[model samples]
Target: MAIDQEILEVSSMFRLLMKKASQDWNRGACKMNLTFPQVQILYSLNNRGSLKVSELADALNLTSAAITGLTDKLCSLNYVERERATDDRRVVYVKITKEGIHAIDSVKEIYREMMEKMFNQLSKEDIQHLMRIFAQMLVNIDN
Candidate 1:
């Protein structure tokens, strides 16, 4: 079977764009002053709401101890609150406060704008094609 050069070209282009997207996230987000892990926790809370440390760690694929450590740091900074369940009294849940919500909301726009600007550099048709391709990839991964 003959290899398609155009297929290889698009694959390389996808890889390059993915690399650039990751790099741009690291660079522009550092200016926002939150580490990537912190951002992940806050974003998780924003989306999932109150969850125990174990749950958060499970969701993030980190150890419970690591999640406890992260939550402690966030707690000290007043970004999150740890509350013992009234019924269980043994289980504790990490809850996002208004500050944490604010922190998450704070970064949402900058990240979106950064990527939007990058995508805007492409032609509208190219952007639409890329979006559909990535959406299919996501569906494949989810399934």
Candidate 2:
């Protein structure tokens, strides 16, 4: 297969778009005291209900100690709590508290507005096309 200028241009544009979108997301995330990992811990807890520290650390690709530190801070702030499993005393689960939920939800509105701004110039069809392209790309990469 031969490369084409159009393909190269589109690929570059896609990379730049992804970069810009990530930057905006980081900016919104920066408003909170949490780093990306800390915020991600909250996201994981919210999504998964509750999980052991090792499990959360594995999901986030961090060491248990690193997650322990983040969880400690979150615990001190009352954003999350450590619980002992009733069935297994040795197992511990971390759950996001109401404060954690509120903190994450508060940033969502602004971040969503940022997403809207990024897509405001595009028509509905364009947005749909972009979604299709992204979905296909995920399939290709994930496999």
Candidate 3:
């Protein structure tokens, strides 16, 4: 095959992989009864601990109104709580609840299972090589 043809095939395969990965993630999120943004909020808080609403919005790259809607739903689900800052009542902090932690664990388990199934055929070395290639691709894209 020509070099350009090989590159085209590689790019097509990358897109297919990304599409399937996204589908898998959506499926997992659905099983947890959470929308993608809601799950993202749980994941963010789980990883970053409690954060102000504005900080959460920045972390998720969402508008303040969008974050408020997500947080409202999460609060209704008993997955998170909001607290007013002691010195500044205007500042509200969002914190994950015990239920939220459980959801985060479930998400992690779901991802682990998805990864195990997806790469069951690959050896350790193969995985490392793919990671290196992906890192290089990221660098190339950044430049």
Candidate 4:
């Protein structure tokens, strides 16, 4: 195939992959009653511990207002808690609760199932090669 044709095919495949992944993810997330962004916030908090609203917004590439709305819902669900910083009364931090950790564990299982279903046909070596290719693509894009 010509380089242009190859590029078009790759782009098409990438879009299809993303669409399928999103659909699968949505179904899984729906079972847990969480949106993708909500899960992202939970995952971030799980990994990074507590963070300020602005910090979470920056880390997640979302606006502070958006983070606040999401965190509000999360707090209502008892998945996370917002606490005022002791040293700085004006600063608030969001921390994941035990419920949030449980939610993340469930999400991890969903992800594992999704990945297995997606790549079950591929051998271990094939999966490794795919990861390497994706990593290189990311590096190239960064440059």
lDDT values for all models: 0.86, 0.87, 0.93, 0.96
Residue-level lDDT tens digits of model 3 in 6-110 = 999999999999999989988988898888889889999999999999999999899888999999989998999999999999999999999999988998899
Which residue pairs show backbone clashes in model 4?
A: none
Q: Taking the tens digit of each residue's C-alpha lDDT, what string does model 1 give over 1-143?
A: 33688779887998998898888888876765676788899999999999988899889999988888888878887889999989998788999999889878878987888878887779989988978998999999999
- TM-scores for every predicted model: 0.76, 0.79, 0.93, 0.91
Candidate 2 structure quality by residue, lDDT tens digits, 20-137: 9888878887777666678889889988999998899889999888989999988987889999999999878899999999987866675788989998899999999989998999
Worst lDDT run of 10 residues, candidate 4, spans 28-37
Error of 3 at 6 (Å): 1.4
Please list the residue runs of candidate 1 whose C-alpha ends up more than 4 Å from where it truly belongs after superposition.
1-8, 136-143
Q: Judge candidate 2 at residue 121 and give its lDDT.
A: 99
Clashing pairs in 1: none
Candidate 4 matches the true fold with a TM-score of: 0.91
Cα lDDT tens digits for candidate 4, 1-143 = 99999999999999999999999999998998899999999999999999999999999999999999999889998999999999999889999999999999999999999999999999999999999999999999999
| Positional deviation of residue 118's Cα in model 4 after best superposition, in angstroms | 0.8
lDDT of 3 at 53: 92
| Lowest-sum lDDT 10-residue window in model 2 | 103-112
Q: Which residue runs does candidate 2 get wrong by more than 4 Å? A: 1-3, 86-89
Best by lDDT: 4
User: Model 1 reaches what TM-score against the true structure?
Assistant: 0.76
Error of 4 at 72 (Å): 1.0
Alpha-carbon runs more than 4 Å astray in model 3: none
- Cα-based RMSD of candidate 3: 1.3
Quick one: ranking by lDDT, best first? Answer: 4, 3, 2, 1
